[model samples]
Target: MRNLLIFCYFLLFFIGLSCKETKKEDINITTDDIEVSDNLQAVTKKSKSILFFGDSLTAGLGLDIEDAFPAIIQRKIDSLGLSYQVINAGLSGETTAGGKNRIDWVLKQDVDIFVLELGANDGLRGVPLSETRNNLQAIIDFVRQKNPEVKIILTGMQIPPNLGVEYTTEFKKIFPELAAKNKLELIPFLLENVAGIPDLNQADGIHPTKEGHKILAKNTWEVLKDVI
Candidate 1:
C-alpha cells in the first residue's frame, strides 16, 4: 500500500513539472514577441527629415502640399524604402536677404538636409548681386555652424534678360561661387527644364505651375539621391 501511494505522488509531481515547463515556454515566447515589437517601433521612429528651404519654387505656390517638390521627394524616398521626411520652408517672394533673416527660425526645427533655393526673388527685385551673395553665404555659414553634418544643396537662378547681361552674369555666379567656397552640393539651376516653358509657368512667369513643380522635383531628386 505504501508503494502504491509513493507511485501516485511521483506521477502528480511529474505532471506538475510538465505544466510549469509549458508555462515557462509560453512566457519566453511572449517576451521575445514584445522585444521584437519594441525594436520595430524604434526603427520606425528613427526616420530622417530633409528640409527644403527656398522661395515659392520650393513651396508649391499654386499647387497643393502633396504636389510640392519636397512632398514629391518624400514620396520617392518612401517608394525606395528610405526613411526620410521633407519639410517645406518656402516663402513666396522670398529673397536671399529674407532667407538670411528667417534662417535662424528655420534652424530651430530638426533639419537634416537644407535645399537652399533663394536668390531668384533677389534677382527679380534687382537686389545687388553682392548683397545676395553675402546673405546666402551668411545663411550657409550659420547652418554649417549649427549642424555640421547637415547637407546643403544650393540651387542657382538666372535673372531675366531685361536685367542686363552684367547683372545677370553676376547673379548667376553667386550660386556656383558659394557652392565651391562651402564645398556644398549644387543643383546648378532649379528651373532648368521648365523655366521658359509657358505651359510650365503660372499667370506670373516668376512662379512655377503644377507641371513645373513635377519637373523641379525630378531635378531635386537627381542630386538628393546621392546625398540620401
Candidate 2:
C-alpha cells in the first residue's frame, strides 16, 4: 500500500512539472508575438501632409473632388510610393482675407507643406492691394506661428487691367513680395500656360477645365518637387 501511494505521488509531481513547462512555453510565444508587433509598429512610416489652401481653383468648382489639382498631386505622390497626404482646403471664392480668417481652423491639422492660392478672388473683386497684402502676410504669419518649420508656397496671380494697371501689377507683385519677405517658395503665375487660353478654361472663362487643372498640377509639381 505504501509503495503504491509513493508511486502515485511521484506521478502527480511529474505531471505538474510538465504542465508548468508547457505554460512557460506559451508565455514565451506570447512575448515573442508582442515583440514582433512592436517591431512592425516601429517600422511603419507616418505620412506627412501637403495642404492646398485657396479658392474655387483649389476646390475644383464645377468638378468632382477627385479631379482637383490637389487630388492630382496626391496621385503623383502615391505613384512614386511617397508617403504624403494631400489635403485640399480650397473654398470657392475664398479671398486672402477669408483665408486669413479661417487659416487657424485649417492649421488645426498637421501641415508640412502649405500652398497658398488665395489672392485671385481678392484681385478679381478689386480688393485694395494693401488689404490683400496685409491679409496674405497675416495668413503667412499665422502659419509660421503655428509651425516655423512649415514650407509655404505662395501661388502668384494676375488680374485684368479693369482693376487698373497699378492695382493689377501690385496684385501680381503680392505673391513674390510676400514670398521674398517670408523666405517662401513661389509658384510664379499659378495659371501659366492655361490662362488666356480659351480651350483650357470653362465657359465662364475663369476656372480651369479638367485638362487645365492638370497643367496647374504640373506647374505646382515643378516647384513642389524641388521642395519635397
Clashing pairs in 1: none
Per-residue lDDT of candidate 1, residues 1-228 (tens digit): 999999999999999999999998777557888989966764576477788888888888888988888888878887887777677888987888889989999889556888898988888888887898999999999998989888999987887777899998888988998999999999988898898889989887767787788899899888989988
Give the lDDT of residue 147 in candidate 1: 90
Q: Write down the TM-score for model 2.
A: 0.80
Give per-residue lDDT, candidate 1, residue 23.
92
For residues 1-228, write the lDDT of model 2, one tens digit per residue.
999999999999999999999998777457888889865653464368899999999999988999889999989997888877788899998988889889999889658999999989988888888999999999989998998889999998998788678888778888898899889999998999999899999999999999999999999999999888
Evaluate all candidate structures by whole-model CA lDDT and list the values in order: 0.85, 0.89
TM per prediction? 0.79, 0.80
The clash count of every prediction, one per candidate, is: 0, 0
Error (Å) of candidate 1 at residue 104 is 1.1
Position 175, candidate 2: lDDT: 89
Question: Which pairs of residues clash in candidate 2, taking residues 3 or more apart in a chain or in different chains?
Answer: none
